[model samples]
Target: MTVLLFGITKDIVGSSTLSLPVSSTSRLRTVGELKDYLSSTYPRLRNLSSLAVAVNNSYAEDSDKIDNFDEIALIPPVSGG
Candidate 1:
Protein backbone atom coordinates (compact mmCIF):
# COMPACT_ATOMS: atom_id res chain seq x y z
CA MET A 1 0.00 0.00 0.00
CA THR A 2 1.03 3.64 -0.54
CA VAL A 3 0.77 6.17 2.23
CA LEU A 4 0.67 9.83 1.29
CA LEU A 5 2.86 11.84 3.56
CA PHE A 6 2.59 15.31 5.01
CA GLY A 7 4.41 17.60 7.43
CA ILE A 8 7.35 15.97 9.20
CA THR A 9 6.31 12.53 7.99
CA LYS A 10 8.00 13.26 4.70
CA ASP A 11 11.27 13.92 6.45
CA ILE A 12 10.94 10.70 8.43
CA VAL A 13 10.09 8.71 5.30
CA GLY A 14 12.85 10.41 3.33
CA SER A 15 10.55 10.62 0.33
CA SER A 16 6.97 11.24 -0.72
CA THR A 17 6.25 7.71 -1.93
CA LEU A 18 6.63 4.65 0.30
CA SER A 19 6.08 1.33 -1.47
CA LEU A 20 5.93 -0.84 1.61
CA PRO A 21 5.47 -4.59 1.59
CA VAL A 22 1.88 -4.29 2.60
CA SER A 23 -1.03 -6.25 1.22
CA SER A 24 -2.57 -4.23 -1.52
CA THR A 25 -5.68 -6.39 -1.23
CA SER A 26 -5.98 -5.95 2.54
CA ARG A 27 -5.23 -2.41 3.52
CA LEU A 28 -3.93 -1.43 6.94
CA ARG A 29 -6.45 -2.79 9.41
CA THR A 30 -5.33 -0.92 12.48
CA VAL A 31 -3.25 2.04 13.54
CA GLY A 32 -1.06 -0.22 15.63
CA GLU A 33 -0.21 -2.23 12.55
CA LEU A 34 0.53 0.86 10.58
CA LYS A 35 2.71 2.10 13.40
CA ASP A 36 4.54 -1.18 13.34
CA TYR A 37 5.06 -0.93 9.62
CA LEU A 38 6.31 2.60 9.94
CA SER A 39 8.59 1.58 12.75
CA SER A 40 10.05 -1.24 10.70
CA THR A 41 10.55 1.00 7.72
CA TYR A 42 11.48 4.21 9.53
CA PRO A 43 12.80 3.70 12.98
CA ARG A 44 12.09 7.33 13.74
CA LEU A 45 8.40 6.74 13.25
CA ARG A 46 8.12 4.03 15.86
CA ASN A 47 6.12 6.30 18.09
CA LEU A 48 3.75 7.26 15.34
CA SER A 49 0.80 7.13 17.68
CA SER A 50 2.02 10.45 19.04
CA LEU A 51 0.57 11.84 15.84
CA ALA A 52 -2.80 11.62 14.14
CA VAL A 53 -3.83 9.86 10.95
CA ALA A 54 -6.17 10.38 8.05
CA VAL A 55 -7.37 7.77 5.60
CA ASN A 56 -8.61 8.85 2.21
CA ASN A 57 -8.56 12.46 3.32
CA SER A 58 -10.51 11.88 6.51
CA TYR A 59 -9.75 11.21 10.15
CA ALA A 60 -9.09 7.55 10.83
CA GLU A 61 -9.55 5.38 13.89
CA ASP A 62 -7.53 2.60 15.46
CA SER A 63 -9.83 -0.08 14.04
CA ASP A 64 -10.35 1.50 10.64
CA LYS A 65 -9.61 -0.74 7.72
CA ILE A 66 -7.71 1.02 4.99
CA ASP A 67 -9.21 -0.01 1.64
CA ASN A 68 -7.40 -0.83 -1.56
CA PHE A 69 -5.59 2.11 -3.16
CA ASP A 70 -6.80 4.18 -0.30
CA GLU A 71 -4.98 7.46 0.25
CA ILE A 72 -3.48 7.25 3.70
CA ALA A 73 -1.52 10.05 5.32
CA LEU A 74 0.06 10.70 8.67
CA ILE A 75 -1.63 13.88 9.70
CA PRO A 76 0.68 14.82 12.49
CA PRO A 77 -0.40 17.62 14.69
CA VAL A 78 1.26 20.94 13.95
CA SER A 79 2.89 22.66 16.86
CA GLY A 80 2.38 26.20 15.64
CA GLY A 81 1.42 28.46 12.79
Candidate 2:
Protein backbone atom coordinates (compact mmCIF):
# COMPACT_ATOMS: atom_id res chain seq x y z
CA MET A 1 0.00 0.00 0.00
CA THR A 2 1.17 3.54 -0.76
CA VAL A 3 0.28 6.43 1.53
CA LEU A 4 0.59 10.10 0.70
CA LEU A 5 1.93 12.29 3.49
CA PHE A 6 1.05 15.88 4.20
CA GLY A 7 2.41 18.68 6.41
CA ILE A 8 4.32 17.39 9.43
CA THR A 9 3.74 13.83 8.47
CA LYS A 10 5.77 14.33 5.31
CA ASP A 11 8.54 15.98 7.28
CA ILE A 12 8.59 13.17 9.80
CA VAL A 13 8.64 10.45 7.20
CA GLY A 14 11.13 12.40 5.07
CA SER A 15 9.10 11.67 1.97
CA SER A 16 5.97 12.77 0.21
CA THR A 17 4.81 9.20 -0.04
CA LEU A 18 5.37 5.89 1.78
CA SER A 19 5.12 2.36 0.52
CA LEU A 20 4.20 -0.64 2.63
CA PRO A 21 4.80 -4.14 1.46
CA VAL A 22 1.65 -6.22 1.30
CA SER A 23 1.92 -9.94 1.66
CA SER A 24 -0.44 -12.77 2.34
CA THR A 25 1.12 -13.31 5.77
CA SER A 26 0.83 -9.69 6.86
CA ARG A 27 -1.77 -7.39 5.42
CA LEU A 28 -3.10 -4.23 7.01
CA ARG A 29 -6.88 -4.55 6.90
CA THR A 30 -8.15 -1.51 8.81
CA VAL A 31 -7.30 2.16 9.11
CA GLY A 32 -6.42 1.70 12.78
CA GLU A 33 -3.94 -1.00 11.89
CA LEU A 34 -2.35 1.33 9.36
CA LYS A 35 -1.98 4.02 11.99
CA ASP A 36 -0.34 1.59 14.39
CA TYR A 37 2.02 0.35 11.72
CA LEU A 38 2.98 3.87 10.70
CA SER A 39 3.45 5.01 14.29
CA SER A 40 5.63 1.98 14.96
CA THR A 41 7.70 2.45 11.83
CA TYR A 42 7.95 6.20 12.17
CA PRO A 43 8.01 6.87 15.87
CA ARG A 44 7.68 10.61 15.30
CA LEU A 45 4.20 10.11 13.94
CA ARG A 46 3.07 9.05 17.39
CA ASN A 47 3.90 12.51 18.69
CA LEU A 48 1.29 14.25 16.58
CA SER A 49 -1.88 15.26 18.44
CA SER A 50 -4.07 14.48 15.45
CA LEU A 51 -3.39 12.44 12.38
CA ALA A 52 -6.23 11.97 9.96
CA VAL A 53 -6.39 9.29 7.32
CA ALA A 54 -8.12 9.80 3.98
CA VAL A 55 -9.05 6.97 1.71
CA ASN A 56 -9.79 7.73 -1.92
CA ASN A 57 -9.97 11.42 -1.16
CA SER A 58 -12.47 10.96 1.67
CA TYR A 59 -11.89 11.11 5.41
CA ALA A 60 -11.81 7.67 6.95
CA GLU A 61 -12.46 6.47 10.45
CA ASP A 62 -10.36 4.05 12.46
CA SER A 63 -12.71 1.17 11.72
CA ASP A 64 -12.64 1.77 7.96
CA LYS A 65 -11.35 -1.02 5.79
CA ILE A 66 -8.35 -0.44 3.54
CA ASP A 67 -7.06 -2.20 0.47
CA ASN A 68 -3.71 -2.21 -1.27
CA PHE A 69 -5.06 -0.31 -4.27
CA ASP A 70 -6.84 2.34 -2.21
CA GLU A 71 -5.68 5.92 -2.35
CA ILE A 72 -4.46 6.80 1.13
CA ALA A 73 -3.26 10.06 2.56
CA LEU A 74 -2.09 11.20 5.99
CA ILE A 75 -3.33 14.62 7.01
CA PRO A 76 -1.71 16.30 9.95
CA PRO A 77 -3.42 18.87 12.08
CA VAL A 78 -3.40 22.35 10.57
CA SER A 79 -3.57 25.58 12.51
CA GLY A 80 -3.94 29.01 10.96
CA GLY A 81 -5.94 32.12 11.39
Candidate 3:
Protein backbone atom coordinates (compact mmCIF):
# COMPACT_ATOMS: atom_id res chain seq x y z
CA MET A 1 0.00 0.00 0.00
CA THR A 2 1.07 3.54 -0.68
CA VAL A 3 0.52 6.14 2.04
CA LEU A 4 0.58 9.88 1.44
CA LEU A 5 2.04 12.01 4.20
CA PHE A 6 1.08 15.57 4.92
CA GLY A 7 2.26 18.44 7.13
CA ILE A 8 4.56 17.37 9.91
CA THR A 9 4.07 13.76 9.02
CA LYS A 10 5.89 14.31 5.75
CA ASP A 11 8.77 16.00 7.52
CA ILE A 12 8.98 13.26 10.10
CA VAL A 13 8.86 10.54 7.48
CA GLY A 14 11.33 12.37 5.21
CA SER A 15 9.10 11.72 2.25
CA SER A 16 5.78 12.90 0.86
CA THR A 17 4.75 9.35 0.17
CA LEU A 18 5.69 5.86 1.34
CA SER A 19 5.18 2.49 -0.29
CA LEU A 20 4.65 -0.44 2.02
CA PRO A 21 5.25 -4.02 1.13
CA VAL A 22 2.41 -6.43 1.72
CA SER A 23 3.98 -9.53 3.14
CA SER A 24 3.17 -11.85 5.97
CA THR A 25 5.65 -10.13 8.26
CA SER A 26 4.26 -6.69 7.54
CA ARG A 27 0.62 -7.03 6.78
CA LEU A 28 -1.54 -3.90 6.71
CA ARG A 29 -5.17 -4.84 6.93
CA THR A 30 -6.68 -2.24 9.25
CA VAL A 31 -6.11 1.36 10.24
CA GLY A 32 -5.21 0.38 13.82
CA GLU A 33 -2.60 -2.06 12.59
CA LEU A 34 -1.17 0.58 10.29
CA LYS A 35 -0.82 2.95 13.26
CA ASP A 36 0.96 0.30 15.30
CA TYR A 37 3.29 -0.53 12.45
CA LEU A 38 4.13 3.11 11.81
CA SER A 39 4.68 3.87 15.51
CA SER A 40 7.05 0.98 15.77
CA THR A 41 8.88 1.66 12.52
CA TYR A 42 8.93 5.44 12.78
CA PRO A 43 9.02 6.51 16.40
CA ARG A 44 8.63 10.20 15.58
CA LEU A 45 5.07 9.64 14.41
CA ARG A 46 4.11 8.71 17.95
CA ASN A 47 5.17 12.13 19.21
CA LEU A 48 2.48 13.91 17.28
CA SER A 49 -0.52 14.99 19.38
CA SER A 50 -3.04 14.22 16.67
CA LEU A 51 -2.78 12.12 13.53
CA ALA A 52 -5.77 11.22 11.46
CA VAL A 53 -5.95 8.67 8.68
CA ALA A 54 -8.05 9.53 5.68
CA VAL A 55 -9.24 6.89 3.28
CA ASN A 56 -10.67 7.97 -0.03
CA ASN A 57 -10.83 11.57 1.23
CA SER A 58 -12.80 10.64 4.34
CA TYR A 59 -11.66 10.23 7.92
CA ALA A 60 -11.12 6.62 8.82
CA GLU A 61 -11.78 4.83 12.09
CA ASP A 62 -9.41 2.41 13.70
CA SER A 63 -11.52 -0.55 12.71
CA ASP A 64 -11.71 0.57 9.11
CA LYS A 65 -10.16 -1.86 6.71
CA ILE A 66 -7.77 -0.67 4.04
CA ASP A 67 -6.89 -2.30 0.77
CA ASN A 68 -3.71 -1.96 -1.25
CA PHE A 69 -5.40 0.17 -3.88
CA ASP A 70 -7.23 2.48 -1.48
CA GLU A 71 -6.33 6.13 -1.28
CA ILE A 72 -4.62 6.62 2.07
CA ALA A 73 -3.26 9.81 3.54
CA LEU A 74 -1.83 10.75 6.92
CA ILE A 75 -3.15 14.08 8.09
CA PRO A 76 -1.58 15.81 11.03
CA PRO A 77 -3.03 18.68 13.01
CA VAL A 78 -3.10 21.99 11.16
CA SER A 79 -3.51 25.62 12.19
CA GLY A 80 -4.08 28.84 10.37
CA GLY A 81 -4.59 32.49 11.11
Candidate 4:
Protein backbone atom coordinates (compact mmCIF):
# COMPACT_ATOMS: atom_id res chain seq x y z
CA MET A 1 0.00 0.00 0.00
CA THR A 2 1.01 3.63 -0.49
CA VAL A 3 0.54 6.52 1.93
CA LEU A 4 1.01 10.27 1.56
CA LEU A 5 2.27 11.35 4.94
CA PHE A 6 3.03 14.72 6.49
CA GLY A 7 4.44 16.52 9.53
CA ILE A 8 6.40 14.69 12.19
CA THR A 9 5.03 11.47 10.83
CA LYS A 10 7.73 11.68 8.17
CA ASP A 11 10.31 11.90 10.91
CA ILE A 12 8.87 8.85 12.59
CA VAL A 13 8.39 6.79 9.48
CA GLY A 14 11.45 8.23 7.76
CA SER A 15 9.58 9.16 4.61
CA SER A 16 6.93 11.49 3.23
CA THR A 17 5.29 8.72 1.29
CA LEU A 18 5.78 5.02 1.72
CA SER A 19 5.21 1.85 -0.25
CA LEU A 20 5.37 -1.61 1.22
CA PRO A 21 5.55 -5.09 -0.23
CA VAL A 22 2.71 -6.71 1.65
CA SER A 23 0.06 -8.85 0.05
CA SER A 24 -2.55 -6.98 -1.97
CA THR A 25 -5.29 -8.65 0.07
CA SER A 26 -3.68 -7.96 3.41
CA ARG A 27 -6.09 -6.40 5.81
CA LEU A 28 -4.78 -3.46 7.73
CA ARG A 29 -8.22 -1.92 7.87
CA THR A 30 -8.00 0.55 10.67
CA VAL A 31 -5.93 3.52 11.67
CA GLY A 32 -5.04 1.71 14.88
CA GLU A 33 -3.95 -1.33 12.95
CA LEU A 34 -1.99 0.87 10.60
CA LYS A 35 -0.36 2.38 13.64
CA ASP A 36 0.53 -1.06 14.86
CA TYR A 37 2.04 -1.98 11.53
CA LEU A 38 3.91 1.29 11.36
CA SER A 39 5.14 0.89 14.90
CA SER A 40 6.42 -2.53 14.01
CA THR A 41 8.07 -1.32 10.84
CA TYR A 42 9.44 1.88 12.31
CA PRO A 43 10.21 1.23 15.92
CA ARG A 44 10.71 4.94 16.47
CA LEU A 45 6.98 5.43 16.05
CA ARG A 46 6.23 3.53 19.26
CA ASN A 47 5.59 6.73 21.18
CA LEU A 48 3.40 8.33 18.53
CA SER A 49 0.07 7.32 19.91
CA SER A 50 -1.18 10.86 19.63
CA LEU A 51 -0.64 11.03 15.89
CA ALA A 52 -3.67 11.42 13.65
CA VAL A 53 -4.47 9.77 10.33
CA ALA A 54 -6.01 11.07 7.14
CA VAL A 55 -7.25 9.21 4.14
CA ASN A 56 -7.64 11.25 0.98
CA ASN A 57 -6.92 14.45 2.83
CA SER A 58 -9.56 13.99 5.50
CA TYR A 59 -9.15 13.18 9.15
CA ALA A 60 -9.54 9.55 10.08
CA GLU A 61 -10.10 7.78 13.36
CA ASP A 62 -8.54 4.59 14.66
CA SER A 63 -11.43 2.50 13.36
CA ASP A 64 -11.38 3.94 9.87
CA LYS A 65 -11.03 1.43 7.09
CA ILE A 66 -7.94 1.92 4.98
CA ASP A 67 -8.01 0.19 1.63
CA ASN A 68 -5.14 -0.66 -0.69
CA PHE A 69 -5.97 2.01 -3.26
CA ASP A 70 -6.60 4.66 -0.66
CA GLU A 71 -4.16 7.51 -0.25
CA ILE A 72 -3.60 7.38 3.47
CA ALA A 73 -1.88 10.27 5.13
CA LEU A 74 -0.06 9.96 8.43
CA ILE A 75 -0.42 13.42 9.90
CA PRO A 76 1.82 13.71 12.88
CA PRO A 77 2.09 16.30 15.62
CA VAL A 78 2.53 20.03 14.98
CA SER A 79 3.48 22.97 17.12
CA GLY A 80 2.47 26.57 16.63
CA GLY A 81 1.85 29.72 18.56
Candidate 5:
Protein backbone atom coordinates (compact mmCIF):
# COMPACT_ATOMS: atom_id res chain seq x y z
CA MET A 1 0.00 0.00 0.00
CA THR A 2 1.08 3.58 -0.62
CA VAL A 3 0.50 6.24 2.02
CA LEU A 4 0.81 9.97 1.48
CA LEU A 5 2.33 12.02 4.25
CA PHE A 6 1.29 15.53 5.14
CA GLY A 7 2.52 18.29 7.42
CA ILE A 8 4.71 17.04 10.25
CA THR A 9 4.02 13.49 9.21
CA LYS A 10 6.00 14.14 6.04
CA ASP A 11 8.93 15.45 8.04
CA ILE A 12 8.76 12.59 10.52
CA VAL A 13 8.79 9.91 7.89
CA GLY A 14 11.34 11.84 5.86
CA SER A 15 9.33 11.40 2.71
CA SER A 16 6.10 12.54 1.12
CA THR A 17 5.03 8.99 0.38
CA LEU A 18 5.48 5.53 1.84
CA SER A 19 5.06 2.15 0.22
CA LEU A 20 4.31 -1.11 1.96
CA PRO A 21 4.68 -4.44 0.28
CA VAL A 22 1.71 -6.77 0.26
CA SER A 23 1.87 -10.51 0.11
CA SER A 24 -0.43 -13.41 0.82
CA THR A 25 1.08 -14.01 4.22
CA SER A 26 1.34 -10.41 5.35
CA ARG A 27 -1.31 -7.89 4.56
CA LEU A 28 -2.75 -5.02 6.51
CA ARG A 29 -6.49 -5.34 6.84
CA THR A 30 -7.52 -2.54 9.17
CA VAL A 31 -6.64 1.08 9.77
CA GLY A 32 -5.56 0.24 13.30
CA GLU A 33 -3.09 -2.26 11.98
CA LEU A 34 -1.66 0.35 9.68
CA LYS A 35 -1.22 2.72 12.57
CA ASP A 36 0.54 0.07 14.61
CA TYR A 37 2.83 -0.77 11.75
CA LEU A 38 3.79 2.84 11.14
CA SER A 39 4.30 3.61 14.79
CA SER A 40 6.54 0.61 15.17
CA THR A 41 8.50 1.32 12.03
CA TYR A 42 8.87 5.02 12.77
CA PRO A 43 9.02 5.29 16.52
CA ARG A 44 8.91 9.04 16.42
CA LEU A 45 5.39 8.85 15.06
CA ARG A 46 4.24 7.59 18.43
CA ASN A 47 5.23 10.86 20.01
CA LEU A 48 2.83 12.95 18.05
CA SER A 49 -0.17 14.35 19.96
CA SER A 50 -2.53 13.04 17.33
CA LEU A 51 -2.44 11.26 14.00
CA ALA A 52 -5.35 11.06 11.63
CA VAL A 53 -5.60 8.65 8.76
CA ALA A 54 -7.50 9.20 5.57
CA VAL A 55 -8.43 6.40 3.27
CA ASN A 56 -9.74 7.16 -0.17
CA ASN A 57 -10.00 10.84 0.77
CA SER A 58 -12.16 10.32 3.84
CA TYR A 59 -11.21 10.22 7.47
CA ALA A 60 -11.09 6.62 8.63
CA GLU A 61 -11.72 5.07 11.97
CA ASP A 62 -9.60 2.39 13.54
CA SER A 63 -12.02 -0.30 12.45
CA ASP A 64 -12.07 0.87 8.85
CA LYS A 65 -10.90 -1.63 6.29
CA ILE A 66 -7.99 -1.02 3.98
CA ASP A 67 -6.53 -2.66 0.92
CA ASN A 68 -3.50 -2.33 -1.31
CA PHE A 69 -5.41 -0.46 -3.98
CA ASP A 70 -6.81 2.18 -1.61
CA GLU A 71 -5.36 5.65 -1.21
CA ILE A 72 -4.09 6.43 2.28
CA ALA A 73 -2.65 9.51 3.93
CA LEU A 74 -1.24 10.41 7.32
CA ILE A 75 -2.35 13.78 8.61
CA PRO A 76 -0.58 15.12 11.64
CA PRO A 77 -2.10 17.68 13.95
CA VAL A 78 -1.77 21.19 12.55
CA SER A 79 -1.46 24.38 14.52
CA GLY A 80 -1.36 27.99 13.43
CA GLY A 81 -1.29 31.45 14.93
Candidate 6:
Protein backbone atom coordinates (compact mmCIF):
# COMPACT_ATOMS: atom_id res chain seq x y z
CA MET A 1 0.00 0.00 0.00
CA THR A 2 1.10 3.52 -0.71
CA VAL A 3 0.76 5.82 2.27
CA LEU A 4 0.95 9.56 1.84
CA LEU A 5 2.45 11.56 4.67
CA PHE A 6 1.45 15.13 5.49
CA GLY A 7 2.85 17.86 7.71
CA ILE A 8 4.67 16.62 10.79
CA THR A 9 4.03 13.08 9.84
CA LYS A 10 6.09 13.56 6.72
CA ASP A 11 8.88 15.09 8.71
CA ILE A 12 8.83 12.33 11.25
CA VAL A 13 8.81 9.62 8.65
CA GLY A 14 11.42 11.52 6.64
CA SER A 15 9.48 11.00 3.45
CA SER A 16 6.47 12.35 1.64
CA THR A 17 5.18 8.86 0.95
CA LEU A 18 5.77 5.31 2.10
CA SER A 19 5.35 2.02 0.34
CA LEU A 20 4.18 -0.63 2.75
CA PRO A 21 3.83 -4.23 1.85
CA VAL A 22 0.64 -6.08 2.66
CA SER A 23 2.00 -9.43 3.58
CA SER A 24 1.44 -11.98 6.28
CA THR A 25 4.39 -10.59 8.19
CA SER A 26 3.16 -7.03 7.85
CA ARG A 27 -0.50 -7.85 8.51
CA LEU A 28 -1.85 -4.41 7.70
CA ARG A 29 -5.42 -5.48 7.14
CA THR A 30 -7.17 -2.77 9.15
CA VAL A 31 -6.62 0.91 9.86
CA GLY A 32 -6.02 0.06 13.50
CA GLU A 33 -3.44 -2.50 12.53
CA LEU A 34 -1.69 0.07 10.40
CA LYS A 35 -1.47 2.42 13.36
CA ASP A 36 0.00 -0.26 15.52
CA TYR A 37 2.46 -1.27 12.86
CA LEU A 38 3.57 2.31 12.39
CA SER A 39 3.92 2.96 16.07
CA SER A 40 6.03 -0.11 16.52
CA THR A 41 8.19 0.45 13.46
CA TYR A 42 8.40 4.24 13.66
CA PRO A 43 8.26 4.96 17.33
CA ARG A 44 8.42 8.70 16.68
CA LEU A 45 4.92 8.62 15.25
CA ARG A 46 3.53 7.94 18.69
CA ASN A 47 4.58 11.40 19.83
CA LEU A 48 1.92 13.09 17.74
CA SER A 49 -1.15 14.32 19.58
CA SER A 50 -3.26 12.57 17.00
CA LEU A 51 -3.03 10.97 13.61
CA ALA A 52 -5.88 10.71 11.18
CA VAL A 53 -5.90 8.15 8.42
CA ALA A 54 -7.72 8.71 5.16
CA VAL A 55 -8.55 5.93 2.79
CA ASN A 56 -9.69 6.69 -0.72
CA ASN A 57 -9.87 10.37 0.23
CA SER A 58 -12.23 9.72 3.14
CA TYR A 59 -11.47 9.44 6.82
CA ALA A 60 -11.15 5.84 7.86
CA GLU A 61 -12.37 4.35 11.11
CA ASP A 62 -10.26 1.97 13.12
CA SER A 63 -12.40 -0.92 12.05
CA ASP A 64 -12.06 -0.02 8.40
CA LYS A 65 -10.41 -2.67 6.31
CA ILE A 66 -7.47 -1.66 4.17
CA ASP A 67 -7.27 -3.23 0.78
CA ASN A 68 -3.94 -3.73 -0.94
CA PHE A 69 -4.94 -1.31 -3.68
CA ASP A 70 -6.47 1.34 -1.45
CA GLU A 71 -5.02 4.80 -1.23
CA ILE A 72 -3.92 5.67 2.28
CA ALA A 73 -2.69 8.86 3.89
CA LEU A 74 -1.46 9.84 7.31
CA ILE A 75 -2.68 13.26 8.34
CA PRO A 76 -1.22 14.52 11.56
CA PRO A 77 -2.66 17.43 13.46
CA VAL A 78 -1.88 20.77 11.86
CA SER A 79 -1.84 24.27 13.22
CA GLY A 80 -1.41 27.67 11.55
CA GLY A 81 -1.56 31.25 12.55
Best by lDDT: 2
The lDDT values for all models are: 0.71, 0.91, 0.89, 0.77, 0.91, 0.89
The lowest-lDDT stretch of 10 consecutive residues in candidate 5 is: 19-28
- Backbone clash total for model 3 is 0
Question: Could you give candidate 4's per-residue lDDT for residues 1-81 as a string of tens digits?
Answer: 887778777867677889865673276877789878887878877776577888888898888887887778777677799
Worst 10 residues of 1 by lDDT: 19-28
Among residues 3 or more apart in sequence or in different chains, the pairs in candidate 1 whose N, CA or C atoms overlap within 3 Å are: none
Query: RMSDs, each prediction?
Result: 2.6, 1.6, 1.6, 1.9, 1.7, 1.5
Residue 56's C-alpha lDDT in candidate 1? 81
Candidate 4 differs from the real structure by a C-alpha RMSD in angstroms, to one decimal, of: 1.9
TM agreement with the true structure for every prediction: 0.75, 0.94, 0.91, 0.83, 0.92, 0.91
- Tens-digit lDDT string for candidate 1 (18-66): 6666453355577657866677768887655576778788887877777
Winning model by TM-score: 2
Candidate 4 Cα misplacement greater than 4 A, ranges = none
What TM-score does structure 1 among the candidates reach? 0.75
lDDT tens digits by residue: candidate 3, 5-75: 99999999999998887672257788988888888989999999988999989999989998888888999
Instruction: Extract clashing residue pairs from model 6.
Output: none
Tens-digit lDDT track of model 2 for 20-47:
7776315788999999988988999999
Predicted candidate 6 versus true structure: per-residue lDDT over 37-68, tens digit per residue: 88888999999999999999999999999987
Give the per-residue lDDT digits (tens) of candidate 5, residues 1-81: 899999988998999999888863157789999999899899999999999999999999999999889999999998999
> For each candidate, how many residue pairs have backbone atoms clashing (under 3 Å)?
0, 0, 0, 0, 0, 0
Which residue window of length 10 is worst by lDDT in model 3?
20-29
Error of 2 at 31 (Å): 0.3
* Residue 74, model 4, lDDT: 77
